[model samples]
Target chain A: MKSFGVNLLIAVIWLLLSAEPSVIAFAMGFLLGFVLLAVFQRVLGSRDYMRRVFALGRFLLVFAWEFLAANANVVWVVLFRSKESLHPNFITYDVTGLKPFEVLLLSYCISLTPGSTTVQVTDDFRTLVLHTLDADNPSAVRARLDRVLKRSILSFTR
Target chain B: MTMTEMLTGMLVLSGSLLILASAIGVLRLPDVLCRSHAVAKALTLGIFLMLLGLWVYQGEKQTALKILLAIFFQVVTIPVGSHLIGLLALQKDIPRWRHRPIDDYREPGNRS
Candidate 1:
């Protein structure tokens, strides 16, 4: 019930933010949400409100912190680096999180960071290839990612 | 000089410099994946700054919105394009530089 509320709120907010919105668009978006909710209910065997709230709280906290950290990292990179000799590399790291949405969030967060981007998601979503400007310390970032993902999973899945 | 003119001039100069820097980065980066990063971030920022300047000078809300939409589209698409290129590079086994010691992903058996 709460997830449905959250989803409905998201739909309304999206409608409000979009350019030149109309009743028809709102109806279309609502219909789409209904269909999605129906599908979600079928796949997950009903929504668990407690679990969803716990998961959402964890995601919000971690995501906010990661965003701030990424922004700070960007400031540091922009200030110290002189735009030369930046050896960029794409490296693959094995991922160990369940849930497709969590994986998607991780990838999007990586892409949002200034010097790093997510390149590919494996077929099973078990691994991701990431392109980073400072590939020297890729493991550190990967470790941080793992920690964040673990926290997310503990909050929601377990 | 007029305030608008000054702003425009600054915007154009900064935008061009950003573009040049991105191009240089792309050319100088060690690997295909790195180069893609340069193109995705620096190039997009350059273009966005440039468009923002043009929009500011125009001072029309609709035009500004359009420019913003353009930027939005670019931001949304650049990552996808960069990701695709990276996947292709990985498929080809392009080597990435590892100056640090703690890359667990770069273990002995993981040299692909």
Candidate 2:
């Protein structure tokens, strides 16, 4: 957080120093700040900032792909698929080892993607109750969540 | 129209079509949970693409920045809002669709 704050500070200083106060200028400044931080990591004592930023970038790319796929899935279900085939049901997802924030993020990501919406979390936070639109293959859903969402989230956070 | 303008128009049109599809899903889906799924995912993506089209059309740095911020907040908030609605419906013991066979959360042994 401190490193991020310093990076933002550097970007803002660059923005102020530059003649054109445009978004490109700000972005350029931010990139410059990122490079500087990377170069002076040992001197600055902020080692993990670059790794976190890269993780964040990867997470964003994965999320964007998921978001597009989600929209496409919804469109298919809504337009082409028959209503009777959809077996909407609440399934339990084991969130045994996730931190509270990671669980929250997982639920939000679940809700945002594909056919799942997290309805409730157990008091112990060990399980999440998710309402899936198409439960014809519940195991498939679980596998996809584990492979795409949970993996990306763990990589970004841990 | 220029290439950028053509691209913007196509994006906006597709976004509108997606939003329309979401509305149709809301009407056609069996229950609240299913309907909310449509609203949360499709509608959010539609709005995002539309804003992206607008950002492309404007082609200004400040406008781009503001639209990016708007998109961020929209993506963050919409899911939370829909999740709360789902939670409330569950709390009210709203009936699930007749065909739904599994409800692991409400099973006697599963309640925490």
Candidate 3:
């Protein structure tokens, strides 16, 4: 398969970078090399490697911070609050500006952001339906996610 | 122990604890949809920290780059898988808690 050749090529490159010249290093590189290909098949599509690298850095920093905050928010909700304190509701997200791939990635980002899970994306991909644990301020949630999280994800698609 | 080792240990410990918290969340949360929320968050954070820790410990360019790649893939996949599972829960007519104010599963245009 084509993936196999790509895998081998990465493994060779790995060996070159590490320069350890040991069997263990090569083996690890081969294994990890395959994984990089498998994992980043989408990311690898971009020919603009230089621009993408910077975008990737920004995306990672933003997501990492959001990820940690989401973890904390969910932990608190589950551990400290009783059912009475929780509010679960659905909200539809506007997906007009984003591409198909960006929309798909957006759902994932939304779900991982503590209080929300995307239940459905419309057939046309024009609308995304999300369920939030705390929907007290649906508009605020929508604005923030749209601006800070989902909008940033658009760069990855380009 | 070296500074890198200490940092790696801390990272791994925190990552494991996040995962442990996710497991508890699955049990404590009332419904599958809510549980999905907890699982998605915890899984992303947990795996990322663990991989980052391993990269720090390894201190090799190739291995570290691959680990970073793994984390990116894992993060991207978790939300999607969880989203599908949550969709299934909705399809099954999983009962919502009393606090649930809306059900847009029919169509957002239709409010019940």
Candidate 4:
């Protein structure tokens, strides 16, 4: 598969860059190479993402912004908000037709954001249960997930 | 220490603060699910910052690559682990310590 080639390229690059040559180094390179490849799966997919490298860059930029902003949001809530003020609640969002990996990756992305943590996927795997630090405005949370998070992930899956 | 070293130290310090925030959430937050919020977000970012600071201090491309690998694995595992823990906590059906009106998951049309 093309993913394996990406891994091989990473390994070769690692071998070329290293000063010492050893089997351990090679093995480490191979392993790390696989990790790198998996991390870029969204960008290097066989069908949908192969030609959307620019889109991938855009996604990363947005993710970086979200990560920084979300961290700040969480930092404020955690450091300043009283326990009584906390509006923690559970949400069940229907994924409907997303691939298994898509659901998993989306959950990971959601978890990394400040206010949200994925609780569990449903028995049929079509629904994902989530918990949030704030759920007073359910529409806002749903908007972010659908308009931003879920849409961005669609490029990887579809 | 050099400026780079100073910066690295600052980064690591900030990372520790985030970790502390997650710890406070664990101890002070009313329930397992709520606390998992801290573990999933703050803790992951904290570990990432520490690793990134170390990567910068190393200042070698190869070292940076290795650090990235470590970070990648950490990022991959943390959410999966957190999700499972949250599921277990849900299965145990432990009521939150506060027990307020926050059970939105039971709302109709929320689940499709």
Candidate 5:
């Protein structure tokens, strides 16, 4: 978080220095700041910053893919699939050791993805109740959620 | 007339179509949870795509930045909104569809 603040500060400084004051200028500044931080990692204690940034980028790409796939799946179910075949169900997800913010992100990802909407989190924050629009196989759905959303979230956060 | 204009038009059209699909899902789906799925995912993505089309059409850095910001907020907030709504419905004990829904949250004996 400190490194992120420093990076943003550098970007803003660069924006002020540049005459155009455009988004591209700010982005270029950010990129330059990233490189500088990387080069002087020992001084800045930003050893994790570079890896976190890469993980964040990968997570974003995975999220984009999930978002598109979700849209496509919903479109197919809505437009083409018959109503009788639909099987909506609630499934409990174990979130034993995840932090609150991580749980929040995971819930948001699950809610935004195909076939699932997170309905509630238990008081202990160890379990999440998800309402899946179609759960032909409950275990399969759970496994997929763990494999796709949970894994990406852990990679970025931890 | 121009290629950019055509691309923008196509993107906007598809985005609207996806939104339309979401509307259909809300009407055709069996229950509130399913409807929320349509609204949260499809509607959100549709709006994002539409904003993207606008950004592409405008082709201005400032406009693009603003649109990106708008997309960020939309993406972050929409799911939360839907989650709250779903949570409310669950708390209220809203009736679900007739389909067999496996609720693992409930005790094995309590499931209906």
Candidate 6:
């Protein structure tokens, strides 16, 4: 019963996020999605469902902070620096998280920042090749990213 | 021309210029991933500029709100698009240029 309720909420969230549905479409789509969810629910089981949502919430909070900082730094660099000050380089940094989804999210967080972009993510998912406008402070930057990722991962998974 | 019309024309011109610059950068960049970055970042800015220009040109609250929505959508979409394309390239085994020894995402057996 608890599993079904969560499944129903997930389906409804999916529907709301995806499209604007007419009353008929909404009811039909929710019914179809709910039925499919029930099958997957039995197969997958409700292992760490709450953990996933909590992890996402943590990621969002940390991401917001990083985003604000990156944007401000970018604007400052653009406004003050001449073309000569720019040093565009691609740097790969080690990411500590284990899960595929977690690694992917970290890569994304790095890429979404203004100065840094993820050019590649390795298959083993341990490393991330990031392009940065200024690669001068690579160590500091990598350490900073490592700390933030650790906080987000630990905050929810623990 | 009225001041409003002149302002509108300038905004449109600037936004169009940004869009053209991004398009050219995407085509001219040496690598696929780099080109994606150029397109993702510049095109987003271009769209924002154009939408804001349109908002200013219309000088209506509703159009301005719509323009804000457009910008919001672009902001959310561009990074996701870039990540998807990058992941796809990795899946396809695209070679990345390494200018120096750095380890953002590089490890033995983890090369994508």
Off by over 4 Å in 1: A1-102, A143-158, B1-4, B95-112
Query: Global lDDT of each model?
Result: 0.66, 0.85, 0.79, 0.77, 0.87, 0.65
Off by over 4 Å in 2: B61-65, B99-103, B106-112
Predicted structure with the largest TM-score when compared to the true one: 5
For residues A1-158, what per-residue lDDT tens digits would candidate 1 score against the true structure? 75567567657876887786865556766666655665686564445644565587877787656654554454444445654656565566776556777677667667655567888887777777777776667778678666765567456645
Error of 2 at B61 (Å): 6.1
Task: Measure candidate 4: CA RMSD.
Answer: 6.1
Q: Mind giving the per-residue lDDT tens digits that candidate 2 earns over B29-74?
A: 8889988898899989888889899989888865687988998898
The interface root mean square deviation of candidate 1 comes to 4.8
Number of clashing pairs per prediction, in order = 0, 0, 0, 0, 0, 9
Instruction: Give the clashing pairs for model 6.
Output: A92-B103, A92-B104, A92-B105, A93-B103, A93-B104, A93-B105, A127-B105, A128-B104, A128-B105
Per-residue lDDT tens digits of candidate 1, residues B1-112?
8898899889877877767766775665566766676666666666767887887787755556677788778766766787788778766776665544334444333445
Please rank every candidate by lDDT, starting with the best. Answer: 5, 2, 3, 4, 1, 6
What global local distance difference test value does model 6 have? 0.65
Model 1 chain A — which ten-residue stretch has the worst lDDT? A70-79
- Looking at model 2, residue B78 earns an lDDT score of 84
Error of 1 at A151 (Å): 8.2
Per-residue lDDT value at B45 in model 3:
86
Give the TM-score (0 to 1) of chain B in model 5.
0.85
lDDT winner, 1 or 4: 4
Give per-residue CA lDDT, model 4, range A3-46, as digits (tens): 65776787888888889876567788988876665567667663
lDDT score of residue A89 within candidate 3: 74
Residue-level lDDT tens digits of model 6 in B50-88: 777787777755456677788789876887787778667
- Taking every candidate in turn, the Cα RMSD to the unseen true structure, in Å, is 8.0, 2.4, 7.3, 6.1, 2.9, 9.4
Instruction: Work out the TM-score per prediction.
Output: 0.57, 0.89, 0.73, 0.77, 0.90, 0.51
Clashing pairs in 3: none
Residue range A1-158, candidate 5, lDDT tens digits: 89989999999999999998887899999999999999999999998988888888989899889989999999998988777888787888888899999998899889878889899987767788998876667888889989988988898798
User: How far off is residue A86 in model 2, in Å?
Assistant: 1.1
Better of 3 and 4 by TM-score: 4
